[model samples]
Target: MGNGLIYVMAVNIVIWIGIAFYLFSLDRKIKKLEREMNDPSH
Candidate 1:
């Protein structure tokens, strides 16, 4: 039972880390697009 709990915790941690990275990258992309839209040369 203890080992199972550890596995669950590890999985959850990994999932959260992945989600955080995905959000970070997504934010960067959105910001870049916004910059492009605001430029007159674009």
Candidate 2:
């Protein structure tokens, strides 16, 4: 029973990490777009 709990916890952590990385990538893309939009030459 303890092993099962640990397995579930590990899976949850992995999923959270994946979600965080996805959001981080999206934020980077948004910042890049914002920079381009604010540039006078764009």
Candidate 3:
């Protein structure tokens, strides 16, 4: 039973980590777009 609990926790942690990474990447892309929009050279 304890092993099962640990597995569930691990899976949850992995999912959250993945989501965090995805959000970080999205934020970076958005920032890049904003920079381009503000610059006339782009």
Candidate 4:
């Protein structure tokens, strides 16, 4: 039972990390688009 709990926790951590990474990437993309939109030359 202890091992099972540890495994579950590890999986949860991995999932959370993946979610964070995805959000970070999305945020970066949005910032880039915003910069382009704000530029006078665009």
Model number with the top lDDT: 3
lDDT of 3 at 16: 100
What's the distance in Å from true for residue 25, model 1? 0.6
Q: How do the residues 1-42 of candidate 3 rate in per-residue lDDT, one tens digit apiece?
A: 687999999999999999999999999999999999999698
Top TM-score prediction, candidate number: 3
Global CA lDDT computed for model 4:
0.95
Over 4 Å off in model 2, which ranges? 40-42
Model 2 scores worst on lDDT over the 10 consecutive residues at: 33-42
Clashes, model 1: 0
Q: Can you give the lDDT of residue 37 in candidate 1? A: 89
Segments of candidate 3 deviating more than 4 angstroms: none
lDDT of 2 by residue, 1-42 (tens): 686999999999999999999999999999999999899587
| Cα-based lDDT at residue 39, candidate 1 | 96
> For each candidate, what TM-score against the reference?
0.83, 0.89, 0.90, 0.89
**Model 3, global lDDT:** 0.96
